[model samples]
Target chain A: MKFSISRSQFIKTLNDVQRAIASKATIPILTGLKIAVSETGVTLTGSDADISIEATITQSDEKAQLLIEEPGNIVLPARFFGEIVKRLPEDQMTLTVGEGFQTTITSGTSSFNLNGLDANGYPHLPEIDAENKLTLPADILKQIISQTVIAVSNQESRPILTGVHILVKDNQLLAVATDSHRLSQRKLEINNGQGLEYDVIIPGKSLTELSKIITDDLEEVDLRITENQVLFTAGPIKFYSRLLEGNYPDTDRLIPHDATTTIEFNTQKLLASVERASLLSHASQNNVVRLVLDPEAKEGTIYSNSPELGNVQESLAFENLTGEKLDISFNPDYMKDALRSFGPTDIKVAFTSALRPFTLVPSEDEENFIQLITPVRTF
Target chain B: MKFSISRSQFIKTLNDVQRAIASKATIPILTGLKIAVSETGVTLTGSDADISIEATITQSDEKAQLLIEEPGNIVLPARFFGEIVKRLPEDQMTLTVGEGFQTTITSGTSSFNLNGLDANGYPHLPEIDAENKLTLPADILKQIISQTVIAVSNQESRPILTGVHILVKDNQLLAVATDSHRLSQRKLEINNGQGLEYDVIIPGKSLTELSKIITDDLEEVDLRITENQVLFTAGPIKFYSRLLEGNYPDTDRLIPHDATTTIEFNTQKLLASVERASLLSHASQNNVVRLVLDPEAKEGTIYSNSPELGNVQESLAFENLTGEKLDISFNPDYMKDALRSFGPTDIKVAFTSALRPFTLVPSEDEENFIQLITPVRTF
Candidate 1:
C-alpha cells in the first residue's frame, strides 16, 4: 500500500481497529492488522474470530492528510505496527509496499521495513442483512452499556449470564445484566427501532471494549443486528460482536415491585458511607455491609464487622424515611457499583425485607433505571 | 493510648513507614505497624526483617495537630490501618486503645474499631554505632541514590552485585553500581568524614525505598554505618537497611581513560532515537542495535534488524563527531538508560574499540559522574 497519511489520524484509526486484535489467536493471521489503500483512502481491519473492527480514513477528510500514490493491500503484525506508529518521530508517515510483501514506513529521519503477509489470506468481513437497523446517539449507547455491563457474571460456568441481555421493543431499548447476586436494568427511548424488536445477548467483554472506543461527542451510531452477529457503526469505525448462544433468564420477575421501607439520601453521601462501611467487610470473606434504617431517628447507619479485623459504622444522613424500621445486609461492592452509575442528585433505596432483594432508583429518573441487589443474611 | 492527630500528617507518616512493610511477612507481627503514642507524640514503625523504617510526629510540630490524652503502644494491620487513615472523613482522627488492645478510630460521623496486637511482639531496631557518621542534604543523597541505583544487578546469583557500593573518604562520597555489563558511578565532595573512611554495600531495593521516603526539603540526613546495618535519619524518619556482605568488584579499572571515537549529542534526542531503535530489537533474542558513525559524513545511523520481523534505521544528528569511521553493535536499552540518567544539555559518547565497554559522560560536568555500558558482539 503506497500512502502518505497524517500520523495522528493513522494512529487513531489503528487504535480503533486494534480493539479486535486477539492477544493469542488460533489463526496467526488474526493477530495481524489488514491495511488496504485505494483511491478513496485507507482501511484498517482487525479480527479475533469473534469480534471484528474496521476503521477508515478518507482522502476527502481534512485531518487525514492522505496522499494516494498507489493502491495495494498487506497485513502487518498488530503489536509491532502499533508500537512503531506510536513512536514515529514525525507528524506524517508514508507507507509503500514493495515486491514480496515488504512494506517500508518512513517518517522524518527514521525508516522501518516490515515483513508483511498477503492480505488475501485474511478473512473478509461478514455480510449481514441490515433490515433491523437502529440509530441512537453514541453517548446514549455508551452510557447504557456501562451502567449494566458491570453486573454481568464474570464466571464461565454460565456462559449466558456473562452477556448483557439487550431487548428492543415499542421504541424502547432495555439492557439488563445480572450475576444472580445483583441485577441492573437500564431503559432508554430510541428512534427507528419501533415494531422491530431484537432480543440478543452480547458478551459483556465486547460491550466494555466498545464503550471505551466510542467517543462521547454525541455522534449518531447505526446498529444493525443479524441472527448471529451485531454490527455497530460509529463515525468511520465499524465494530462487530458475535451474539452469545442460549436463552437468557427472565430477570424481570426477580426485581421487587413493592417495598416495606424506603428512604431518600444524597447519592454521593450514601456512596461514601457504603464505601467506608465496606472497608473492613471487603477484607473479610463475605464482603457484606449492613444498612440499619431507623425511621424515628430519621437517619440510617451503615455498619460492617469483621471478627478478625475490626468493625466500621457510618451514619448516613437522609432527606426522608418512610415505612417501618429495617435492617438489611448486602455485598458492599454491588451497592457501590449501582450507586456510582445512578445519574441524579438523590437516590431512593427501597427494601422489601431483610432477606429479600433491594432496589435502588435515581429519584429524578425513577422510571428509566433500577438496580437490584440481593441482601446477604449476616445474622 | 488516646490521641488525635491531623489526618494528612498521619497519612503521610503512615505511607512513609508502610513502604518497609512486607506484602507477606514471615513474622506475623511484622505485618502490622507498631504505633506508640506518648506525651511527646506518636511513632509508627514498619519492618520486613531486612529493612525497618520509623517515622515520628512530635507535638511541637504545628502540623502534627497531636493531642495526647493518654499513652499506649499497640500494633495494627499495616494495610488496613493505612487505608482507613487515608479515607477518613475528617481533618483529624482520634485514636484510643482500650483494654485488651481494642483500638477505636473516630472521625466525623465515622468510627472504626480495629483489633490490635501487643507492641511487645514487634522486633526492636538494631543499634548502630555513630562513630562513623556523614551528614549531607537529603536532596543530594536522593540524587546520588537515583543516579547509580538503576545499574545495580537484579539477579540473585551474585548477591553482592545487587547492592550499590558506597565509599566515603578524604572528604569525598562515591557511589558505584554495576551488573557486570554496565556500571554507573557518581561522586560528590562532602564536608564530613574527613579522616574516617567506610566502604559498605547497601541493597539497591533498600536504597530505592529510602529514596522515596526522603523528601527534597533541604533537610540534612545523618547516615551511620555499622558492621551489619546502616541507619539513615532524615528529619523525623529513621531508615535502617541491612548491608550486603561480600567484597565489591573493583570497577575503577573498567573505565577507559582514552577513546578513539567520541561524539557529542543532545541527551534527549539521542535517548529518543535509541528508545525507538530498541523497539524491535527488544523483542529479538539479542536485543542488539548497530551504531555506524561516519565522521566525514558528520552523521550517525542507528540500525536494528530482525530476520523474522523487520528492520529499523534512524539517522541521528550530532553537534560534533570527531571520530574515525566506526561500526559497532550494542544493546540500545543500555544506552537509553545511560542517556536518561545524564543531566546536561549534551552528552559525550566515548568509545575505545568495538569490543570494549564505552563511557557516556555529561559534556558540561564530566568529572562528577560516568556511565559505562559493555557492547554486545552481534557478529
Candidate 2:
C-alpha cells in the first residue's frame, strides 16, 4: 500500500481505531493495525478478540488531503507506529509497502521502516447486513452507556452482568445494567421502527470504547446486530463488538415499585454533601452513610460514622418531604454514583425503608432514567 | 483546636502540612496532623520520619470573623479530616475542642465529630534557630530540585545516592545527584557570604514534597539548618525535612572538560525527534538511540533499531556543528529528561565520543544550567 495523507487527519483516524488495538501480545498478529489503501482513500482497522474498529479517510473530503497511489494492504504494530507518526514534526505523512512485509512511514525528515505482518494473517471483522440495522441518536446512545455502563460488574463469574442489556420494542428503546449491588436503567423513544423486536447484551467495556469515538454533536448512528456481533457506524467509522450470549437477569423486579418517603433535593448539593460524608464512612467496613428524614423540620440529614476515626453529619434543605420520618444507612459511594448519573439540576430520591432499595430520578419528567441502590445493613 | 477561620485559608494550610503526613500506618501518630490553638491563633503540623511541615494562622489576620474560644492542641487523622474539610460545601468551618479530646468541626449545615489524640502524644518538631539562616529565591530552589532530583536513585543499595547533595561555598551553591549510572550537577552564584562552608544531603523524597508546597511566586525562603534537620520557612509555612546522614560522592570528576564535537539545534525539535525514535528503541533489550553527525553537512541523523521491530531514522538540521564528526548511542529517556530540565529554545550538545558522557545546555548564555548523560555502550 502506498498513500499520502494529512498528518492531523491520519492521527485523528488512527486514534479512533487504536482504542481497539490489542494491548496484550498473546497473539502477536492481533497487536498490529491493518491498513488498506484504495483509489478513494485509506482505511485503518484495529481489533482485539472482543472489539474491532475501522476508520476510513476519504479523498472526497477536501479537508482530509489524502492521495492514494497504489491499492494494497499491510499490518503494522499499532502502538509504535502510532507514536512515531504522532511525534513526527510534519504536516503530511507517507506510507508505502516495502519488501518482506515491511512498511515504510515518512513524515518531514523522519522515516520509519516497521516490520509488518501480512494483512492476510489478521482476523476479518464480522460482516453485518444493512437489513438488520436500526438507527438511534448518538447522544442518546452515549447517555445510555455512560449511565448504565459503570454499574456493570468487572467480575467474570456471571459474564452476562458485564454487558448492558438493550431491549427495543415497537417505539421505545430500553437499556439496563446491574452488577447485583446497583443497577441503572434508561429508556428513550425512537420514532423510526425497524419492524423487529430484539434483545442483545453488549459488553460494557466495548460500549465505553465506542462512546469515546462517537460525537454528541452527531444526530444519528446506525446500529446493526448479528447473531454474535454488534456493529455501530457513524460517518466514516465502523465499530464492531462481540455480543455477550446469555439471559440477562430480570432487573424489573430489582427496582422498587412503591416508596414510603420521597424527597427532592438539588443534585449538586446532595453530591457534595455525600462526598464529604464518604470521607469518614469510607474508612469503615461497609462504607455506609445514614440518611435521616424529618417531616416536621422539612430537612434531610446525611451522616457517616467510623469507629476509629470520626462521624460526619450534613443537613440538606429539601423541596418537599412526605410520608413517615425514616432513618436508613446505605453505601455512600452508591448514592454518589446514583446522584451523579441523574444529570439534572434537581433529583427526587424515593426510599421505602432501611432494608429496601431506593430509586433516584430527575425531578423533571422529560428524562426517563432511574438508578437504584440497595441500602447496607449497618447494624 | 478551638478556632473559627476562613475555610479557604484553613484548607490551604491543611494541604501544605498534609504533604508530610505518612502514607504508611507504621506509626499511627505519623498519619495524623497536630493542631494547636492558642491566643496567637492556630498552628497545624504533620510529620513522617523524613519530613515535617508546620503552618500557622495568626489571630491578627482573623479580621474579627475568626474567633478563638479556647486554647488547646490535638492530633486528628490527616487524610480523613483533610478530605472532609476540602469537600465540605461551606464558606466557613468552625473547629472546637471538647471534653475527652473530642473535636467538633462545623461548617454551614455540616458537622463532623472526630476522635482526636492529645497533643502530648504527638512527636515534637525539631527546634531550629533562624539567626544563622540563609535565604534563597524560592523559584531557584524549586528549579534546582526539579533539575537534579529525577536522577537520584530510588534503590536503597546506596543510601547517599538517594539524596541530593547541597554544597555551600563562599560565593556559590552547588547541587549534585546521581544514581551511579548517570549524574546531574547544577551550580548557582550567590552574593551572600556567611563565611560558612557546609555540605548537607537531603532525601530526594523530602525535596519532592518540599517542592510541591514551595510556590515559584514566592520571592525568598529562609533556610535554617540544625544538627539533624533543615527548615524552610516561607511566609506562614514552615517546612522541616530530616537530613540524610552520609557522605555524598564527589561528582565533579564525572563531568568531562573537553569535547570532540559540539552542535546547536532547536531544543523542541530534537526532543520530538528523540521521542519518535524512542518508540522503536524502547522495544529492544537496550533502549538506545544512535546519533550520527557530519560536521561538513551541518546536519545530524538519529536512528533507533529493534531486532523484532525494524528501525527508525530521522535527520535533524543544526544551527551550528563543529569539531570532529561523531556517532554515539544513549538511552533516549535520559536525553528526554535532560531536555525537559534544560528548557530553552535552542540547546547546545557537547559529546566526547561514542563511549564517553555528553553535556546538554541552553544555547543562550543567560540561562546557566547544564545536564550530562552517560552514553550507553551498545555492542
Candidate 3:
C-alpha cells in the first residue's frame, strides 16, 4: 500500500476513530488501526470489541488531497502512528508497505519504519440485516444522549443500569436512565417513528463517544438497529455500539407526580449557589446540602456544614412559591448535574416530602423533559 | 478586624502568597494565611517553614479599593479561604473577625463563618540583617533561573546538588547547576556588583517559585543576603527563601575547553527532531538516541529505535560543520532540556570524544551562557 495525504485532514478522521480504540484491549490486534486502501478511497477502522468506528477518505475529497499509488491493506499501532504523524515535518505524509510487513512512513527528511500486522486478523464490522433507518438532527440527538446519560450508573453492581433505555413508539422517542438515587428522562417528538415500536439499551460510554463525533458540521444522522449492534452514520464516519443485554428497571414509576411545595429558580443562578454550598458539603461526611423553604415567610435558604471545618448558608432568591413549607436535603453533586442539563433556563422544582423523591422540569416545557432526585432524611 | 476589599485585587495578592503555603505542612498553623489589618493597609503572609512570602495591599492602591474599618489581625486556612474568595458573588467582599477568633466573610447574600487562629501563634518572618542591597531587572532574573534550574539534581542522594550555585564577583553574576550528567551555566554583567563578592546555593524549587512571582509588571527586584537567608523584594511583595547550608562543587574544571568535532544548528529545529526521536527512545530500555555526524559529507542524522515497537531517523539540517566524523549516543531527555534553554537561536555544539561530555553555547554570545551534556557509551 502506498499513499500520501494532507496531515490535517487525516488527523481529523484519525481523532474521531481513536475515540473508539482502547489503549489496553484484551485482543492484541484490537489496539492496531486497520487501514484499507482501494482504487478510489481509503478506509480506517478502530475498535475495542464493544464499539467500533470507521471513516472513509474518498479520492474526490478536495481538502484531503489524497494520492494513491497502490492498493492494499495493513494494521499499524494506532497510538505510535498517531504521534509520529502529528510530529511529521511537512504538510503531507506518505505511508508505504514493501516486502513482508515492513511499512515505511515519511514526511520531508524524516522517515519511520514500523512492523505492520496482517489485516486479516482484525475483526470485521458487525452486519445489520434490518432495512428500516431512522433519521434525526445531529444537535437534538446529541442533547438526548447527554441529558439522559448523566443519570446512568457507573457502578457495576447493577449492569443493566449502566445504559440509557431508549424507546421509540407512537411518533415519540423517549430516553431515560437511573442509578436508583436519581433518574433523568428526556422526550422528543419524532415525525416518522409513528406505528413503529423499538426498545434498546445503549451503554452510556458508547453514547458519550458517539455524541462527541456528531459535531455541529453534521446536519443529520441515520440510525440502523439490528438484534445486538446499532450503527449511526454521520457524514463519512460510521459509529457502531453493541447493545446491553437485559431489561432496564422501571424508572417511570419512581418519579413523583404530586407535590406539597413548588418553587421556580433560574438554572444558572441556582447552579452557582448549589456549587458554593457543595464546597462545604463535600468537606462533610454526608456530602448533602439542605434546602429550607418558607412559603408564608416568602424566603428560602441553603445550609451546609462540616464538623471539623466550618459551615455555609446562602439566602436563595426564589419565585412562584406555593403550598406548605418544607425542608429537604440531597446530594449536591446530583443536583448540580441535573441543573447543568437545564442550561440557563428557569426550572421549576417540586418536592413531595422531606424523604420522598423530588422532580425538576423546565418551566416552559414541563411535560417533555424531567429530572428526579431522591432527597435524604437529614433530620 | 473588619475591612472590605475588591475581590480581584485581593485574589492577586492571595495567589502570590499561596505559593509559599504547602497543603501538607508539618506545623498546622503554617497552613493558615496570616493577615494583618492595620490603619494603612492589609498584609497577607503564607509560609511553609523553609520559605515565606508576604504581599501587602495598601489603602492608597487604586485597584485594591481597600476599606479598613478597624485594625486587628488573624490567621485563616489558606487553601479554603482562597477557594472561597475566588467564588464570592460580588466585586468586593468584607472580612471581619470578632471575639475569640471567629471570622465572618460575606459577599452578596452568601456568608461564610470560618474558624480562625490567633495571629500571635504564627511564626515571624526571618530578619535578614544585611545593609548592602543589589538589584537586577525582573526579566533577566527570571531568565537566569529558568536556564540553570533545569539541570538541578532531583535525586535526594546528595541534597546539596538540588540547588543552583550563584556567585556575584567582579561586576558579574554567575549561576550554574548540574545533575552530574548535564550542566547549565548563565552569567549576567551587573554594573553595581563590583567590589562585592558573594556566593550561595539556592534550592532549585525556591528559584522556580521566585521566578513565577517575578512577573513582567515589576521593574527590578532588590536582593539582600545575610547568614543563611536571602530576601527578594519586588514592589508590594516580599519573597524570602532560606539558602542551603553547604559548599557547592566546583564545575569550572568539568566543562571541556577543546573540541575534536564542532557543529552548529538552529535550536528550534534540533529540539523538534530530538522530541521526535525521544518518543521511540522512551519506549526502549536504554532511553538513548544516536547522532551520526559526517563533516566530510556535510551531513548529520539522528536515529532511535525500540525493540518492541519501531525506529525513526531524521536527516539534520545544520550550518557550519568543521568536525571529524563521529557517532555519539546520549539521553534524548537531557538533550531536549538543553536545546529548549537556547530557544530559537543558532547554537554551536562542541564534542571532545564519543564518551566524554559535550558543550552547547549560543553562537552570538558564547562566553555568557553554556550547556554541557555527557554522552552514553553505547557498544
Candidate order by TM-score, decreasing, is 3, 1, 2
For candidate 3, the iRMS in Å is 0.9
1 or 2, which is superior by TM-score?
1
Clashing residue pairs in candidate 1, if any?
none
What is candidate 1's TM-score for chain B alone? 0.97
lDDT of all the models against the reference? 0.90, 0.86, 0.93
lDDT leader: 3
TM-score of each: 0.97, 0.95, 0.99
Model 2 residue B78 distance off true place after TM-score fit, in angstroms? 0.6
* Cα lDDT of model 2 by residue, B314-372, tens digit: 89878779989898899999888878887757888899888888888777852356778
The residue ranges of model 3 lying beyond 4 angstroms of the native Cα positions read: none
User: How do these models rank on DockQ, best leading?
Assistant: 2, 3, 1
Model with the higher TM-score, candidate 1 or 3: 3
Give residue B280's lDDT in candidate 3 (0 to 100). 91
